[model samples]
Target: MAPTTPRPPTMRDVARTAGVSTATVSRYVNGLQRFTEATEARLREAIDQLGFTVDPVARSMITGRTHTVAVVILDIRNPHFTGIVKGANRKAQQLGYNLLFVDTGERQSAEAGMLRELSRRVDGLIVSSRMPDADLSTLRDLDKPVVFFGRASQVGVHSVSADGRSAAAMLGRHLIDLGHRRIAYLGYGAARWDAERKAGLTDALREAGLEPMFFSADSPTLEAGEKSVGEVLMGSARPDAVVCYNDMLALGFMKQAQAAGVRVPEQVSVAGFDDIPFARFSTPTLTTVDMQSEAMGELALERLIELIDGTLDASEEMLKPRLVLRQSTAAKVRT
Candidate 1:
């Protein structure tokens, strides 16, 4: 024969021990109402003596809120996303809420499905998506309050993002000042931020009476950057400087270029966006833009909570980007 299991203390047990009504106990436990100093002390003592704990599931059922938020990102492996998640998690924990994350693998199809499933389980959402503007507009219709992390929409949703266009323009002007005439941009075509970054680079080059060259990478990764070396660095119209979409690509391009007997900065300068952790430690170091990813993440979570509480209107917040100079870029040498 097995011994019977003991039952956990309930709100009724706490109420009886404190000599208070169950309704009063419920109000106190759920923070729905306040009690006098003497009454509160008795309740606290009773709860301690009875070893009573609030059941989160039962509380949520009664309050109609789980006190949980979900974050949807494109790629978990990218340090940019990692920084965002870290910030959101910290903010969530501080506010006594839980965080749920879903990686959509940079696929738009998967993103939609994941959002639908997550909306039912969480009180709000923070999304960093790569879907089209039309698809993004539909996010406003989701059952939960939504805050976009890296992209903005016209459909009246809250969003937080770094100023990528301005940052890319700053990088472009830096290369131009270095006397690099044939400057080219290498980027992933599928990225939602690619168009703005390209436009920023184009704007800077046009101001200097020069046309910007464009190149595409299958994805924003080291391998894609390495593979483009032959076509971008060894072609007839080899660029004197290259601005990659992210640090991963810049480092990869530098590695393969050096392996092929080409010198970095000396022959071809390189720069990238997103000053990831490894950027400064790479060979020759890397010149990149700091997107303030962690701060944006924290801001996104704050905005989402405000939206959930009906305290904020639909608006977008754009953080400024800063350029970090390093040894990877230098003035072009006259032939």
Candidate 2:
């Protein structure tokens, strides 16, 4: 005959051991009522002795809250997104909540499906979406509190994001101060921040009585940056400086340019956004903008929780970006 499994300790066992009624024990366990010190002590002792643990499923059924929050990001492989997750997860654990993460692989359809499914299981959501405004507007019907990350807020949704335009303008002014004229922008067309950053750079250049040259990368990856070296660095009227969409592209561009016997910050200066960890450790230490990725994540989670609790109305929070100076950029030498 198969061995019988021992039954797990239940509230009845705890109540019996503590010499209390089952309803009293339930109220104590759920923090729904206060008891005398002696009674509370006895209940605690009984719980400890019996190794009693609250059943999450049962508690959730009673409270209508799963104590779980979901975070949806575009790409898990990117350190920026991972940093956001790390911040949110840390805060969730501290608040006695659980976190569920989903990587949409930069696909709008996948993002939508995951949001719909997760809304049913989690208390709230945090999304870093790349979808158009029309598609994102429909998320209000999910009936769950949502906080947008790294994107603009919709009509009724809260959002947290770094000021990309101001940050890019700061970078542009820095390069201009370093005497870098004939600047080119290497960017991915699909990024939502692309237009903002580009406009900021253009604003700074126009202030200096100059216009920027534009180049496109198929994607915002290291390989795309490396591949653009020929057209951006070696072609006729080669730019004296190039501002990439992010750190990965800048690192790749620097690597390829150096391999082709070009000097960084000497022949052509390079800069990037999103001051990722690898940016400071790379050869010539990349100059970039610090978007406060982790802090944004933490704030987004907090805002979502407040929304869930009905303590906060839909709003937008914009984080300030700082410019990080490094050896990758310098005063342009006159030919």
Candidate 3:
């Protein structure tokens, strides 16, 4: 027969061992009351000898707080989201809070479902949404504190994001200055950030009297970039340069272009937004924008915690974007 488990120690057992009343033990253990130094020392010794641990669930039942946060993002496979998770997780651990991460797989419909379910279990949320402003507006009714990441909402959700339009305009101006007249844009489907970047790039190009070529992908993955390269190249009008939505897409285009023997920065210059880790290690280091993902993550978590603790005021934060010039883009050689 299996050995019987020893009786788990209780507050009464601790009180008996420490020569204190059970009510005194309960109050001291839960920080509801203070005790004399000698008494506190005796109670600590008793607790240590009993090998007792406080159950978080039991404590939450008494205090009405789970001390946990939910972080919702799209496409965990993307390094940008992973970086945000890392920063957010680090802070959550330091503050004795549990983190629950949910990936919506870039589906706007799935986000509403996640928000509904997870809000019941966690104290607050940090959401990087793919949903439209109208859909996000409904989150105002969610009974928990929330902070939005990477996109702003008209629904008055506290938001933290990098300026995508400025970043795109900067990249477009760089390409235009380098003699890239016919520029192609490879972007993902509808999203506020996407529209802002696209409009910024289009405006920059049009200002220079250049017609911007547009190509789109279902997702912002490497496969999407590889699959769309053929149509972009096979068109009647070929672009001398391509600016991609993100580094992942640009990497895909580079992979396919190299396989087809197209020289990068020689025949066509390529650039992307979001200077992820692989952007620096690529064959020809990618020219891209750094959106400060880690900083964004940290700020988002800080804001969420403040919201949860009733210390944060509703506000919007926009981080600056930096350009990392590299080997992938060059001065176009006019033939």
> Which candidate achieves the best lDDT against the true structure?
1
lDDT of 3 by residue, 1-335 (tens): 99999988999999999999988887886656888999999999999999876687886786677888988988899999999898899888877788999988888766677798889999888988777775777566688888987554466678899999989999899999998999998988665578878988998998899878998977899998888788877678989899999989999998898888888989889999878999999989999999888888888888898887788777788999999999999999978
Q: Answer with 1 or 2, whichever has the higher TM-score.
A: 1
Task: Report the Cα lDDT for residue 163, model 3.
Answer: 92
State residue 136's C-alpha deviation in candidate 3, in Å.
1.2
lDDT of 1 by residue, 64-126 (tens): 888899999888888888989999999998877899988888787666777888899999999
Task: Give the Cα-based TM-score of candidate 1 against the true structure.
Answer: 0.90
- Candidate 2 ranges beyond 4 A from true positions: 1-9, 12-50
Clash pairs, candidate 1, are: none
Ranking by TM-score: 1, 2, 3
Shift in Å, residue 64, candidate 2: 1.5
Span of ten consecutive residues with least summed lDDT in model 3:
149-158
Q: Could you arrange the candidates by lDDT from highest to lowest?
A: 1, 2, 3
Give all candidate RMSDs, comma-separated. 2.7, 2.9, 3.6
Show the colliding residue pairs in model 3.
Answer: none
